[model samples]
Target: MKREIVLLAMFTMAIIFMAGCKQHGTPKPRGYYRIAFPEHDYKPFNKKSPYTFDLPVYTEVGDGAQPQTREKYWYNINYPNLNGILHISYKAVDNNLNEMLEDSRKLAYKHSVKADAIAERLFISADKNVYGTLFDIKGDAASPVQFYLTDSVRNFVRGSLYFNSVPNKDSLAPVIDFVKTDIVHLMETFEWKEMPKL
Candidate 1:
């Protein structure tokens, strides 16, 4: 009888333990996540850095890499380390500068639609209203170059680029800010292709 009672008690205890083990509601997994960013070992542009701020040597000015339709005219600077590319262009818009800024927000959303992460990105305020885009390897290879369009006769400019990876916005903030500084420098140095001096 005692043996039978002990077995019964054990069974009851097991039942209670199992019941407790069974999650009452939705159970979450157990694990820790780590987010690590690389160290910043960058160099400034070799040519006269018409603009301020030091750009990474991993970045280099390249020939017109973007197609013609992208904008009237645009150029690219390769960011090989980050496996990224920065494409910049100028396009005249019918609307004014304010309207362009509003539209820029829409453009960013449109670009993010196809990407996985927002990546390091932001707006250009140090100089003018130049919309910027940075990407992280999220999906099939995407154009790392961000395209910006402006109507401000005072400063009609557009800039775009693609990041090597689908970068998280929070993590890339510093880098993006640094890139923006260079872009501002680019704007200052921006000289419309000499129109044959006609």
Candidate 2:
């Protein structure tokens, strides 16, 4: 009788274990953490510089120009909370307009290897006399947005957005889109300052 009771208990335990091991349905895919974005309130960045634009109230501008390599007008629009920076460089066109445009195109395309697609939008402001192109890069590229604004004359400005962390488009998409709107606002309010004659 003890032997039979032991067998029944073992059988019951085995059935319970098998039932526990059976899955209910298909497993859901992995998910990432949620991101919180700030409001889009902006303030004018009209410092004593070669150009002026509207930057997000949450951002701070720093000198991006290095003593060794970068020019005087290079600046970085830093998003501290978002961990991203938009490097803006200014160059005066003495006659190298074509070369400058070519270089801008090349710099933007360098990410094409990792980028899924690059969409170019031509920006022409007849009132502001600003003519240039904005490059929106899709995918896991290091720099997902790059643009160059020129009067097609004297002032040429190139800006590229980069994050401090690893390039994960899926995770950074919200941040990128948020910053992109700020950039668009910058572009809309962008104006060239009159450079002093050297």
Candidate 3:
């Protein structure tokens, strides 16, 4: 009877070992958190400013030239929900159009080390006399978008998009695309303010 009890215990142990060795497939890849995007509705920003454009209603326009000296028309489109900001700076053309254009190009290329590619798309509105180039940067660059709108004679406005968090192109792709559309809308509605007589 004792011998039979020992054999039964061994058999049970063997069955448990066989059950633990069943096939297990490879581990699944990690995933990122889902982001909730707001509606794409926008409103005209035709306030008492040097220029006017349409911006998303979800954002706020604030002075970007503060803490140094508040310049004439330097502002930022703040995206509180997405932790991002679009810095816009206006410069009056005073025989420095070439230099200004060069500066804008250099600024966009600064991220070439980290960016996989930089695409420049020309924008022109003959009726509005708006002309500019939009820079769409790919990869893990700090700033994914930079653009400049100019009348090519008297007004030059440069804008750049930056995030408050770490640079992760893959994770930020959706937000970047959404903001890109808004930026394009802004360029479409952009108009330069007439300079006062000197």
> How many pairs in model 1 have backbone atoms within 3 A of each other, for residues 3 or more apart or on separate chains, i.e. clashes?
15
Count the clashes in each prediction. Answer: 15, 0, 0
For residue 176, model 3's alpha carbon misses the true position, in angstroms, by 0.8
Could you give candidate 2's per-residue lDDT for residues 25-55 as a string of tens digits? 8889868778777889998886667788887
The CA lDDT of each predicted structure is 0.50, 0.90, 0.90
- Model 2 misses residue 165 by how many Å? 0.9
Which parts of model 3 have CA positions greater than 4 angstroms off? Answer: 1-19, 22-25
Off by over 4 Å in 1: 2-6, 9-13, 22-54, 66-74, 90-157, 164-198
lDDT of 3 at 79: 96
**Location of the lowest summed lDDT over 10 successive residues in candidate 3:** 189-198
TM-score-sorted candidate list, best first = 2, 3, 1
lDDT of 3 at 60: 92
* Candidate 2 backbone collisions, by pair: none
Give candidates' CA RMSD values in order.
7.7, 1.9, 2.2
User: Judged by lDDT relative to the true structure, which candidate is superior, 1 or 2?
Assistant: 2
Q: Identify the leading candidate in terms of TM-score.
A: 2
RMSD of 3: 2.2
